[model samples]
Target: MRRSILSAVTISSLVFALGACTPKPDQADNAAESFLESLSSHAEPGEFTDNPDQAQEEINSSWDSLQAEGLNTSLNNVRTNGNVATADFTMDWDLPGDRNFQYQSQMTLTKTQDDWTVRWQPTVMHPDLGANQHLELRTVPAEMATVVGSDGAALLQPGTRYRVFVDTSTGDLQSTMRQVAIELDAMRANDESVPSIDAEAKAKEAEQVDGEFSLLTLNQQQGLDLKNRMSRVEGLRFNEEQAMVRPDPNFAPDIMSRVSSVVEKDLEGSNGWKVVAATSEGSEVRELGGQDAQTAPSVDVSLSKKVQDAAQAAVDTRSDAKVMMVVMQPSTGGILAVAQTQKADEDGDAALMGQYPPGSTFKILTAFAGMQNQGLTPDSIVGCPGTQDIGGRIVANYNNFSLGNTALENAFAKSCNTTFAQVSTDLQPGQLQQTAKQFGLGVDFNIEGLDTITGSVPRGDVMLERTEAGYGQGLDLASPFGMAMVASTAASGRMPTPYLIGGPEHRTEAQGEDGNQLPKEQLDNLRRIMRSVVTSGSGSGVASAGEVYAKTGEAEINGGSHSWLTGYRGDLAFATLIVLGGGSEHATSVTNTFFQNLDGK
Candidate 1:
């Protein structure tokens, strides 16, 4: 009985040791092979793979350093009662070469009959691409129309929709009409308000009606030519719109370019309506949308022959420039007639798109910030040897000459950089950036395709550079649109929200409900200074038509210069930028031309 009991004890001890030696199924899978299968299934094609040997080699090659870099893997939970089991694990590692990026992955795997499988949400995992990443190019609720200004009239009109009959072999007018009607019914069912034309009736009647597309004649070859003209355009197509025919071939490219943009697209089309591809210059035939569908009421602008002659004269002499001559109503800010040297359709880049250095024009902003934030006065005296050392760097006045001892007015009149830089340093650094933001610098304009660059003030070496930068020297960059905002803000005394879209618009909700966009007091402070500049300061070179408030700037660089002028005449605010890549005289010359024209107008 003693020997039997000893034998049982020995067997029981052996059984316990065997159980301890065997691993849990989950622990066996978590050893690295399972991880390779799980990661490879979900990884992008370029980076991760399924081969355990390869993965081990990659990790092993850098294992010692990776271990030091705190690369870790942790197993959280494992269940293995049934044939299928679940394992949860996490991997954390620093990317090899890139310090800026760190990766962490949590994986949960379900054991299949033969292998482990993973589930991933591609949309959530990769948000930067796939269907969710793109902005849908949706069709507008209704066909988009255009607002056009001609003579003195502003016309808003709906566009025409036409289907050209290129092949007579396809059908007669009645059959084509029937086809058009069927398609029209189908289109209306899909989108309730699609407009359709009666090709059969139009072929019979031939009268041009308002809000209706007229049937026009085109041969098969003519249709092919038209299609070729419209090959590059998408969304809304054109067989025909308005056409201008000129005798001179040289003028055709210019005319075609202009007319193409104003053409409207119809709702049913795959491409926008545009000019028929043709270079013909005199009395070319094409279709236009009927008058009634237009949004703005068409009115004839009655300009005197004298005004027309003057406009023509302005165009004739300024042939080289891409000009956009805007005549606006000061009281309402309604642009009257915006005439350009090119055709009606080619609205050139300069209209609201041009950008240039603001030069001394920006000094008014520094001056205002100085007075409001640092308790500076217009009469305050600044030591202007015309140059000074700023934080171990020397900054010189505009002409590099001494004004000796000067008051604020004299310093401003002389466009003194030293005074501006000193003032910039005295004010809080944050104040300059904040004030510029307040005036809409770095903000996008509502106008499509135009970018407004907000000027930046530097911090360390850049900051000292920006002290001179305030006068448009170091790190000063601005768009004409941005400069206009600054000028308008200074002119109006409140930070005026500038818009290319015109209106007697009221102030935003952030301001008081009174729609007093600018404060009377702020306007008073800036107005006096700007008026002083226009009359007797740096801007005095430009003759003012009335009580014009302005400032002129000259930015000199290593090889060239950019000149600037921004000001307000009555309620009309404007900013001009010119770059003359060589002599300083060229910079001033261009500015003087604009000023001369502005004064004459």
Candidate 2:
């Protein structure tokens, strides 16, 4: 609002009116347009403005702070009142980055002696633009949205991460790395939520770098602890950044890290800009106009917080070995959880990509091959000898344990190596390989936001190789992810497509569209046999939890054996593995604890 104040003044000199005719309305409009053109060009308008020199000075002084690219003006309307006229015009300000600011304001023009001149005033720039004021553009960033899980629970939110690194100049690099891991572990024990690092890999990478190399990125509390504890350590540095992070540090840290890398750009929306009227002192007076930024949408993942916590806790029980467990929903093929202990993290997501001999778990495929090719049934009698020679290589049961002659179901439950070895030897090459793919093993899923490699089943013409492959001894390999798929196929009859992200554009599609489906009756019989393994055989450790179906295995490697268990209970199909964890009982115990914890919840 404009106000008028009364003040008494004495006239110093008398002025005489010029004998000139009033200019037309068109002349006023044209003069007003010329004045705007002068403002844009930062120059004085000749003979078109009452005070061109004063307007030129105001244009340069007021608009200098705007840093505008250019200005455009259009005359809206012009009203004539004898010698004085009002011209309403709109100004379009071209700003940086293809942005524009537009507003309507009015200017006055005086007519005398057949000439119309624009009368200068701050209001010509903007209606609310005050004296000694100019327009300034400022950009404001929008807030990132939360990343939710399948249950609509928050999985990740906007947060800060501090990357800590080490300089190789530090004395005794290996000893320093060991100490760093120890101190970091101590800090994590205090919070019980900090994510763990691959210390051995981090050390090896640092050794290859010249000056400094990053070790790990920690959440807020973890970073603060590092500063308080290790800031004084020589050759250590820290850098921080705003990032999307998991709320529960203990809930699938490594998996969530991978998720963040894929969804970060989508979560950060476009930035908004506004034009504000400011005084010469750069103090904002009022907002002229601007657009607001669109709200950024949240990301959704397939992880269940309750299930992930349970699996993570189950694996954390033993920190001695690299224990990993992958759980899947057979009905929808959603990845329920990918949990690994700190020791397992050192192997860089071995649960999804690491391949190892599956031991007796391979019997699942061998048994299916027998049923499909040899027309065998669960009630069919099979030989379970202590030791048997098939074409040259000798296949023996664990400690040469013999069950004599037994039903196929009982032999499967007992994980009879000799019996399955004989069954595999009977089938031709590529038969087991085809059966493996039918069970979702050895098939590439090409999942989005996640990289995975299913296990491998070889096609060899040699009888000994086929015999060893039957018991998962010679050239069979399966990752936890692949084994989990096998268990899912067993439960669902056909292999369900796996996906970590829920949206179709960011999801894992059905890559096995042309893959074979398991025979229903035979699969039912297999499921029954797998249940018996849990009911009265090798998987008895988890029998108390529920009607869990499973196959237990201990593949003998160089130093020790890899514990393996793959099966399903209800909608949850899973595979648990422990590298060099000795026996399948260790994997079974972990699975039991996982189920117990889940059921307890």
Candidate 3:
């Protein structure tokens, strides 16, 4: 009986010891899940480990070292034996380039004081990660794409150019930069193709930089020509690398620069850089186990080489003042040519962005408004006096020229300011505004690779303001491109929406129809009046270009006036502005040259 009782007691004690040593499977699973969830949450370190602050600090440091979009973890197959537990888990990281990096890891836990706790380690996230080691993302940039003009001609090509630099860390950087600048200036003085260098500015810029700093960029030919001279200078270094190249140095610099500048915000999804896993020191980088980078497609523009060359030459020959010219296809609204002289280029892209008084150019819309609202035809009788007081302001024609009791057609052909001003008093409010909208004035356009400004026309409330608007003066502002569209509208009898890139399929929807907005008969009458201007009035100088219809404007400014001409020949429409060119006659001369050259006459 005694032996039996002793054996029973021993068995009971053995069962109690085993129960204390082994942990339940459900408890181990709960601990594993809590540990994985804690990775992305703010769980207290003591809740999962013995070393509270150290474990928290380690987790925070690991997370901070990694650059990823997001992280996900899941635990499964949990098992426990004695006081130890193990769980199989998967860790997935969402990275750039639409990639997901995944790996399997095992988590270990221990039962302490009747609670299951996870053993914290960096390897829990990544098996290979060690102390002072972390995961990093490295991006490999894709090859740049070229820009092609009409007919697959290369407009911008990727090639190698030279950069002149000064070694700031090694020698007298400022003095070296100044010497290089002097050499560049001397070369530029003798060679027109060499770009200018400012010695003082170069010295100042060198002082703000460290190590090797670039002073100027030169084309391959230019760099080769100056290599011997540049080599003689101390502390000057020449580095050659890939850069954007153009066949002609100044072939649409502003527009091409916008296309070649690669930035993060504008990078297309399929053509973007690839993100990869790398060591903390960025020595070994491996693809996040994903596909390679895709090739970027080229961009095609609508610029015609013949028209652009001709337009550029015509503007470049002018030494008197700034000039800008724009050419377009009236039917499709395709911008074929945009040219500006050096003087105009210094003032930015004035051909597409300048805001100047339209002068007599606005008369086109005013005439349409008059016929639509006041029931006036092109032949309606109106008086053209030398000077007339209109709503407390005196208005007159150019040089106070006038013809008494003249027809409206003659007044429009001669650009009589007083006659249009008088006629403006008869139209209703917003009449001119409504008419101008039909001609694409005050409308926004979205061209793929171009920045532009159309024009603006205010609603004149008082009689004087209204009268001023009638002759294109009061609060009427337009760019050369805007006025070109106006001419296109008159030619095609539809509001023209211009585009610099893409084809007809990319054009924006029409704003409004000409026939729906303005009277068809009146439009025909306006066309005739424009033809008369070229045939018998201020625009007569350009009439030799063959059936050309045009309007001439001398917009009055502080010093003098800006010369303006908007016209069309056959299917082509054009606009030109000579900044402060004195009178409409100069604009007429520019128009003559443009049309004469356009027709190769």
Top lDDT model: 2
Judging by TM-score, tell me the better candidate of 1 and 2: 2
Error of 3 at 601 (Å): 4.0
Per-residue lDDT of candidate 3, residues 42-151 (tens digit)? 34543587556766766654455444555667664677797898877776766554566777777678888689888866566567656544455545555556667764
Q: What is the full ranking by lDDT, best candidate first?
A: 2, 3, 1
Task: Compose the digit string of candidate 2's lDDT tens values, residues 177-202.
Answer: 77678887888777777656666777
RMSD, every candidate, angstroms: 24.4, 8.5, 11.5
lDDT of 1 at 108: 38
Q: Which pairs in model 3 have colliding backbones?
A: none
lDDT agreement with native, every candidate: 0.45, 0.82, 0.73
What's the best-to-worst order under TM-score?
Answer: 2, 3, 1
Model 2 residue 243 CA deviation (Å) reads 2.9
Give model 3's TM-score versus the native structure. 0.67
Which parts of model 3 have CA positions greater than 4 angstroms off?
Answer: 1-144, 150-153, 187-194, 207-210, 262-296, 446-451, 503-519
Candidate 1 per-residue C-alpha lDDT over 1-601 given as tens digits, one digit per residue, 9 for 90 to 100: 1111010000011121346468434432443234433333323221222334433333333222222233334444554545444444443332223221122333334445655543322221112212212111111133343333333322333333334432332324455445545555555564433345665674454233223333343223333443464343332133544332212212223222333342322212232221111112222133211112223322222222232233334443445543333232233323222234453125344434444455677787777777667766667787677679877768787668777777776677667878887888776656766556555554444321122343544442456755766777777667555666666566555444332222222211222112135445545666777778767776665544566777777777665676566666666555555443332233234334544554475
TM per candidate: 0.47, 0.80, 0.67
